[model samples]
Target: MKERIVVKIGSNVLTRKDGTLDVTRMSALVDQVAELHKEGIEVILVSSGAVASGKTELKIKDKLDTISARQLYSAVGQAKLINRYYDLFHQHRIVCGQVLATKEDFATRRHYLNQRNCMTVMLDNNVIPIVNENDTISVNELMFTDNDELSGLVAAMMGSHKLIILSNIDGIFDGDPNKSQSKVIREIDTQKDQIEEFIQSSKSTAGRGGMQTKYNIARKVAEEGIEVIIANGRKDNILIHLLKDKETLCTRFIPSTKGVSSVKKWIAHSEGFTKGEIHINEGAKDALLGEKAISLLPVGVTKVTGNFETDDIVRIIDESGKQIGIGRTSYNSQKANEIIGKNNKKAIIHYDYLYIEK
Candidate 1:
């Protein structure tokens, strides 16, 4: 069977050099997706360019500051961008759904699972999901940098075998794309940190993410046991060439290191937006990490924090204020509070579904 794939096309590929929507390029890509779907391969697209499209549609005159420009451009661009994509995909007889995600979407465990379930159901129904960041309401752009991390999270959520990043450049170059002697890196392994010093910081038109950011995301997604390919989207038959030919000139981040499964990685990384926290004693921390197969006794819990319901993801912190692990809580905050520092009957975090810190 063909592998499930997630393709992220950046704004530079979807927009003209002057920052207007490139309808021709968009149509061509959509047609390629339609052809790929005919082969029975599932493809989900994470697209950018709403703000750039909006800027062209709105026809704003003067140069604006960072905050004002993003707020206005995103407000103007989001609907028009989706409408264009909808029209293009409609011609290909492919149904597309819009999903606007913020940093908080994957921060909480409940919201994370809900998102995963929603995408799974959509893919099962043969509907392609077009995901983008909610730039209008997002305030974490400075910290999150760009939607590269968002694309990785979506790929991990969908358990995709491959992630193709369609950008303007050919691939990762040694010196820079503008330089004549800059060599394209065809394969990247676990020793990517060695090439970190050679990477140059360069941003593209119509988007905030640069090559450096994409490289960072590629490294991260590759670590999750997913193959990541970075290539030029403007090239003709780019998608077809990538999937069919192994000799294609692209930076391929191979999944070399093996780790826990996708579910465990998700559980381990969900630190933000946790409803509650369990401060465990040192002995309990050791037991959880070791071969104890024991339920979390109340005597092991030193304190409980935050307001959470049953089955919410909570941090397992040690007495020294260090995070020991993350696990699904079996009881609410109030219930766990009552059982703290006592020999309780119920386990706060059961043995099953409980992941200890490594």
Candidate 2:
């Protein structure tokens, strides 16, 4: 069956060797995606290259040090980038919508759902949605440096079956890409701990994001049961090769053993995390996990730390302060403090709002 997919193309693949927009390559990619759409697959693209494309158009040679200069470049480049995509996709008679998002959008539940709605509406109308980080107005701390991370979140939000990241390299290497002995890892499986050692960090001049960021996002999305493939974008017909022929030399991260449903996966890896915590005794912890219900009774409550409001995501800790799980709270910090250590009237956290850690 045709599946929903999120494709992330990095700046290195979108720009020429001299930091110019590679129009030929961009057109080729859009063509492949258009073909996929014809096959009935829901395609969403997370693209990066606004700054680089802008730098080339304006002929600005001086280094942009200050945040303002970077924003100015992004402001100019983002328009040019989207315009190019608009022209390219139009050739295939495919309508596409542009969505520029910042970290703040995903940080709140309301904005997250709003963004989801916009994407859904576009897709429902048979229009492809092209997403990019709002770099022009977003500060460094509040920005997503790369499209790799953005693609993962979008995949999880749209309940996409797979996330395909296109970079300059073939795939994840065992060691540094510069090292001759580094070997490309074909597949990653149930072992998250074991794979950490092989992960290496490196940055791209054309883009601020690196290999490590891709690996981190891929791992997180894979945990949500969405397969993630990090492959080369520069290769001809690369997008079609992956979906049609599966003929790419990419690092494919498989799903974990404990398969989770799409809705459950979203709840487990919700965007905003709570700063508060609630500690439970061993008996309560087991009951929450085994029974899978929410009102955490005072009988299991051992301690409460941090101030959190109702519906906030809070960590569920054990008596010794180990985090056993995470769940949305049913009450505020003051109310939790009032009920902790006693079988009071309120259940601090109800069962349906909880996600016990595995």
Candidate 3:
């Protein structure tokens, strides 16, 4: 099998300082991807720049409400973005497809499988698929955290060997980017590294995601046995450089030693899409995290929060109000409330549908 990889380009990398789409940068990136395609490496691109592109094109001086502004900008910008991609890819005699996805697409097994199949067909036909969140319609709960999160899910779904995230900054820093001495961390072992201290909570001017979001998604995907690289997109021939040289100045996350099942990866990545939460006692938490594969019983549940139906994805919280994991519930909120701490126990979440977090 050929080496498959997913490449995510941030809005900061695709837009100029004036907030307009950077045609030169886009062409350069596309050229690199075209070269990789010629080398027989399957590439799926997850791009973020629609809102910025739309805002620049509309030139609206007055401020609009959040939802309306996003809708207007994304609605206008997505067309321009895809059209540019089409023209650029066509120049290299390569066909590219646009796939706009929402958070709801990964909510269930059927929907996830459908999306997986679509991407599979596109790749099998030697066509590159450009994926982006449906920002025009997504609002509040329906929205993905950012394209970083969306790309992670897409990479996992496609069973890609690697995920390459392109950002404006040169990977992750040890301290702060503003500081001159804060050196870039070149390698990250997800199983051993404590990276929380180095990550700062800051959003980009042109995009919703920050360095923290990238770190999180990178760590999550790495845990599922996928290599993740965070590098500077503005650097000349960045993708090509990474492929040709292993000594590139980029943050590389090593995959976990233990492999995760496809179903478990889906469940683990669906934390943002959970509908409700279940609070369990220490004993239940221990059993789930321990050697024996055990189902969540009604007797172990102390409290249930949020109204959710059967088969809805929910977070499993410990008694201390910390999230331990997530799973598909076999019982609804009402039924779960009735059966808490009783001798007549029923499986609230079956072992097959449960995934314990590390």
Candidate 4:
């Protein structure tokens, strides 16, 4: 099988100091991707620059609201951005397709499968799929955390072997990147690494996601058995060096050896789309989190909160109301409430459908 990789280029990487699209930088990045593509590597690019691209051509005379401004800018910008990608990839004789997605697309099984199939067909036809959030329609609360979150979903959905997040800075620093003493941590063991204390909570001036968001998405993707790299996109030929020369300037996330099934990987990223909550007793919580793989039976369910139908994703809570995991329920909310603490009832969630947060 060919090695499939997902490269996420952030807004800061593609925009100039004057808040305009940096055409020179965009061409440079595409050149590196072309190098990898020529080596028979399957690459999916998750790029961000549409809003900044729109800013160059249009000056808002009338004051617009935040969401309106974003919609207006991105609506105009996505077209310009995708066209640039088309011309750039055309230079390399590569056919690239645009895939704009919103959060709601991944809300159900059918939509998720459709998205996966579309990208699969694109790759099968030797077409590079350039994915980005549909910022024009993805307004306010419905939007992704940023392209960082979107890139992770794309990586998992495509079953990519690696996910590379290109940012303005070098990588996750031991301290603040602005300070001279701060240094990038070389590698992260996703299995037991703890770097939260070092992760700063600062949003980028050029994009929605901060280093914290990148770290979170990286961890989640790494847990799903994909190696993740966070590197400075400002540097020349970084992508080529990372894959070809095995460069070490970035922070690399070591993938987990305990791989999950395709269904579980999707379930892990579907936390946002869950429909209801299932509160279980201490014994149930312990058993689920324990070494033994067991299904969630109604015998341990103390309370069923909200409403959800069969096959709907539900949040699993413990006695103290902390969310321990999520799973697809086998019964509807009404059925679940009636079967609470019943010994002979069917499993509320089978082991296969459950995703426990370790």
**Tens-digit per-residue lDDT, 174-224, candidate 4:** 998999999999899977889999998999989999999999999989999
Output the lDDT of residue 143, model 2: 70
lDDT of 2 at 300: 82
Instruction: Estimate every model's Cα lDDT from 0 to 1.
Output: 0.81, 0.81, 0.92, 0.93
Please report the candidate that would top lDDT against the real structure: 4
Better of 3 and 4 by TM-score: 4
Q: In model 3, which regions exceed 4 Å deviation?
A: 61-63, 342-346
Candidate 1 yields a Cα-based lDDT of 0.81
Worst lDDT 10-window in candidate 3: 337-346
Q: Pick by TM-score: which candidate is best?
A: 4
Relative to the true structure, candidate 3 reaches a TM of 0.96
Instruction: Count backbone overlaps in model 3.
Output: 0
Better of 1 and 4 by lDDT: 4
Report the Cα RMSD per candidate: 4.6, 3.2, 1.6, 1.0
- Runs in model 4 deviating more than 4 A are none
Tens-place lDDT digits, model 3, residues 18-72: 8889989999999999999999999999999898778877977889999999999
Supply candidate 2's per-residue lDDT for 114.
91
